[model samples]
Target chain A: MNIILFEEKEISSTYHIQITDHRAKHIVKVLRSQVGDRVRVGVIDGGRGMAKIVAIKPKFPFSVDLDIQLETTLPEEKPVIDLVLALPRPIMLRRILSQVTSLGVGRIFLIDSQRVEKSFWQASLLQNEQYREHLLIGLEQAVATRLPEVSIYPKFKGFMDELLVKDLDDYSALIVADPAGTNTFSEALRQAGGSLRQGGRVLLCVGPEGGWVPAEVDQFSGCGFSICTIGERILKVDTAVIALHSRIMALREIL
Target chain B: MNIILFEEKEISSTYHIQITDHRAKHIVKVLRSQVGDRVRVGVIDGGRGMAKIVAIKPKFPFSVDLDIQLETTLPEEKPVIDLVLALPRPIMLRRILSQVTSLGVGRIFLIDSQRVEKSFWQASLLQNEQYREHLLIGLEQAVATRLPEVSIYPKFKGFMDELLVKDLDDYSALIVADPAGTNTFSEALRQAGGSLRQGGRVLLCVGPEGGWVPAEVDQFSGCGFSICTIGERILKVDTAVIALHSRIMALREIL
Candidate 1:
């Protein structure tokens, strides 16, 4: 983990906090931290800072208690990108959750689609605590404090017709990924008027393994979502998420 | 699999070929192909075409014999990007091989670096046939025929001092990824005089987990490698590779 993260409930006082979970064990065993060592630490959905190790007590099997002093607040930035993904297989969803969160997406909407397997909606990975766990893993890896909001939409039409239509104005642009799209992502951005770098929010929609159905594509187009392709290559969902996100982030910098 | 891949030796005659391997079983069971069914197929390091299932013999427990006609050819494209990566773990390497290959890299140099684990060089995953298996998987996924070349560099200094110095002129730009780099990738491309989109080859070097040491960074700088950062977030090696490749491909289209 790049930074040690603890929830608000874990803190006993303003400056002193006692950690007894896996994070404490990781600090003592994996990091080999000493009494006086200062390690990077962050509060869940709060701020990041250094934690000075004050006490290391090996009290239970496979566990330890660490007393640390929270030092300062980290410089934080607001998240600009949001993801609208068709629910993938449970295994791939878990990986995507961690990876995309680390890449700094502000929100995620795992919605159902014609190509998504019905069984995927029943997966326990979509549970609140489970999703939060994966998000925390990502936050720790990226050394970020803000937790991105994640929502599940088991019904496709309701999500698109009701929820999305209401929230469309929140984003500066809405883009959908399609292999046969005539516009490259760069051209899509240009057609949208300009880059998303000017503090504007973006909502990027990626399809399932089989890709968006013709009806779904038409629905997206009708809702004013620009269709763009990463290129000719058919990328797996996880890979495509990173590719599309990276491409946007890249263009936001130079365009 | 997007396209059924076969080694060059598997093509028996000018118009037809027979099969009785797992690929054949996959065609019969997973794909549910019968006589006269057409499946996309490609010859390794050759051309992509359609293979018609002329006959299906299910006499063996887990095998099927298929007679086919090779028809048509895929449009061939030249590779433009080359990768220089510090070898990741075996599991990650397997994914990297397929993923990077599908992204259309020309050559891959799995080189040792200061932060790279020595044991990584000893991984059986680096074995010729094993590596080729992953590459084939990538080609099958992307429906591409030509395979990218992979090379191993067990010794860091020697590869940098001997091979790299001698072959520096082959690529138009040499870029290295560093977290502390002042320039974003776009700025680096601008510094290199323009876009790599005009058929110019690019060599992208990504550091190991902990990143390149000062000495290694200095050596790269001495050899005219422009240093660029993806951003503030620390990305895992696999994520970084896709992100970097995606960024380059995106810029190639716009700039």
Candidate 2:
């Protein structure tokens, strides 16, 4: 991890905090850190912190001295691109999580769809924190300090009723990824004009293996989602997400 | 598999061929073919084939009325992009292969860099035939039928000695991806002239985790390569490949 993230509960004081969970074990075991070595650290939704290795006694537990109060908000320039995906197979889900996280999206919503196999939900990877580990690796690779909030909703109807229509607010553009959709991503991106530096929210939705049903398409359309495509090649859910995000970033001129 | 690929040695007669190997197992067991079922197949550099199940007797053997003909030819469009990637970990290799293939690139040269872990080469996934499986999946996802030729040199000096000093063959752009590189992808794309559809070979190079040393950058520039970036946000090797491909595609209007 480039910048270690800790919850508010982990911070015992303004400048000193004790790490005893994964971070501590990671620092002591995996990293094999020695005394006087400095490690990059941060807090979740807070600023960054640096931990100086004060003591290293393997197995017993190691200690570090924290001296940080970082204003580690995602740089104001990078726009938040949130994705709504109809969960693919387990293999696809792992890649999607890493790709979306690497793109620096603010969040990801794994929603259920008619074409999605029900057995996918029971995969061992999704049961434990296996999926979240992938996201952490993505975040670390990106050198970003924050991880996207990931939540799984069992059914699209419940997600629509409980999350989408009622809770989501001030979205600049709501895009549904349909291969045969009317508008092209280029046109949609050009139409949804905004400076990514201003923190505009763009939501991208991807369907399942068989693609979205007509009734589901109508529901997304009714929810004011703009349908778009990234050329004729039918990219998988993860590939499509990165391609779209890159194009949007280009249009926004954030890069 | 959209189009089954066979080696030159695998082709026997014009109308018939032996059914054995891993694919044979998948076709017989996983598919549970009975009779009169239509299946799509293709040859290595040949064309797509349709094999109708004419006879089957559990484990004993099976027969099919095979029609191996070119239903359609893959686009003659020469890939404008040539990818040079410092090899990634085994798990990420499949994603990289498929995504790069989906991007419709002309060549992918997975190389060794100073910081790249030597142990990566030992992974069983790197075996020639095994690696081909990942690329096939990518080809099917993007609906591009032509398979990319993969060549592995294993050692850094060997790779440079073989291909580095060779004539670049009127290649217009030489782009390199480094985390701390100069200029954003937009600036680089705009400067690279247009995409490959206009007949320009752009060599895009990407470094591994520890990134390129100064010596490597110096060598690249000496041979004609300019280091570039996607943005401040760090993207992993796989994500960077797609993002860079998307920009090049956009510049060429392929998006």
Candidate 3:
């Protein structure tokens, strides 16, 4: 576990972490961590700390005595890479959540695209916050302490013209994933370079499974957004996101 | 499978397919493929054909009668890109499979890296036909007919010496993945171009989880292998494979 997450109530007056919740079961039952075992712990929206187990109750509502100490604290200045993507099918949505969080993105703006399967948007996984849980699981795997804010945009043009570009004025770069566009990923990163310099507040756009219909692609292209291809192979959307970031990261000398 | 795989068989005048394995289960149970169902099929070491099923019986050794006609297939040559990689964990292996297939590589040489967990090699998923399953699945996704040949070399030195430089009378470009290497993926790809034009195989090596150690990097550099970085963020190996190919495929001008 990179950083074991906890809620505020888990912390005591002396800054000791009282193990509880699902993670508590994981530590005790699954991991079988005994007394004196070191367990990494961090408050969900709080500081990172590790606890040394001094005691345990290995049952429901389990508890563990804590001797907590802070380790590497994260920087408070969080940069967001909010993705505004057309909602994909349930299976693809599951993968996308993991990919976004694994890449350290901070927000998701799931928008409707003409090509997106109408039935896919209505999937139970999207309507409720179950996708949120999956994204959180990915974040946990990535050791990210922050969760990306997820918002759904049911309408396309209304979001693009009225809310997005206007409200996201601080964003230094905006990227859209389109197969037919001319610029390579390297070129896209060059355009996105401004975002890293200004801080990590950037916006990325990806289309649905069938891809943005010709009209939607035209609409996106008319904006200053550059289309970048990760490779000649037609990658699934989740693979594309990871592939896109990998290229961008390499160009920035951050591999 | 995007394209159902088949083995060559001399069937009855009706051209029956011996549906005795997983493919049979998939067709019968999953696809509910019945008599008169047409399916795309690729003959092993032969050509792709469409089969119209004539009959299906759940005999102890089940069989499906097929009327197959092979196509006038052009030989789509596999690029002489030999991948020398540290076997990534199972999770990473899935993406690597697809990425490698998409890159149009001819062969893969999986090696054990120092940083690679010993237990990873022990995973049953990497043994037997499991790895091939991953590759076939990936190839299907790309709608590509040819499957890359894979060779597993558990030891690093054997891979580097025998299968690598020893096979070369002419210069085979050697590029290794390194964060602080002599060049970037672009520079390295450029260097590989001259060798590629000379008509020898191109050998690209990607490191495992934490990457090749400094001494290993130095060893490759001494052997005239160019050390290159993908970028700043340490991407998972799966992402790196796709990203590396993204640039390489772009270098191919097929993008």
Which model scores highest in DockQ?
A: 1
TM-scores, all models, native as reference: 0.95, 0.85, 0.72
CAPRI grade, predicted model 3 = acceptable
Evaluate residue A100 in candidate 3 and report its C-alpha lDDT on the 0 to 100 scale. Answer: 65
lDDT of 3 by residue, A88-178 (tens): 8788788778766656676677888888877877788876687877765655555556667788877888777854466657565667777
Model 1 lDDT tens row, A59-175: 454343345455555436767789999999989888888888889998899899999999998888886558788888888888888888887888889788765657888877788
Residue-wise C-alpha lDDT for candidate 2, range A1-35, written one tens digit per residue: 55566666776755666666667777777677887
Cα displacement (Å) at residue A135, model 2 = 4.0
Cα deviation of B128, candidate 1, in Å = 3.7
Task: List pairs with backbone clashes in candidate 3.
Answer: A106-A148, A249-B231, A250-B230, A250-B231, A253-B232, A254-B231, A254-B232, A254-B233, A255-B231, A255-B232
- Every candidate's fraction of true contacts kept comes to 0.71, 0.65, 0.18
Arranged by TM-score with the best first, the candidates are 1, 2, 3
TM-score of 1: 0.95
Decreasing lDDT order of the candidates? 1, 2, 3
Model 2 chain A: worst 10 consecutive residues (lDDT sum): A70-79
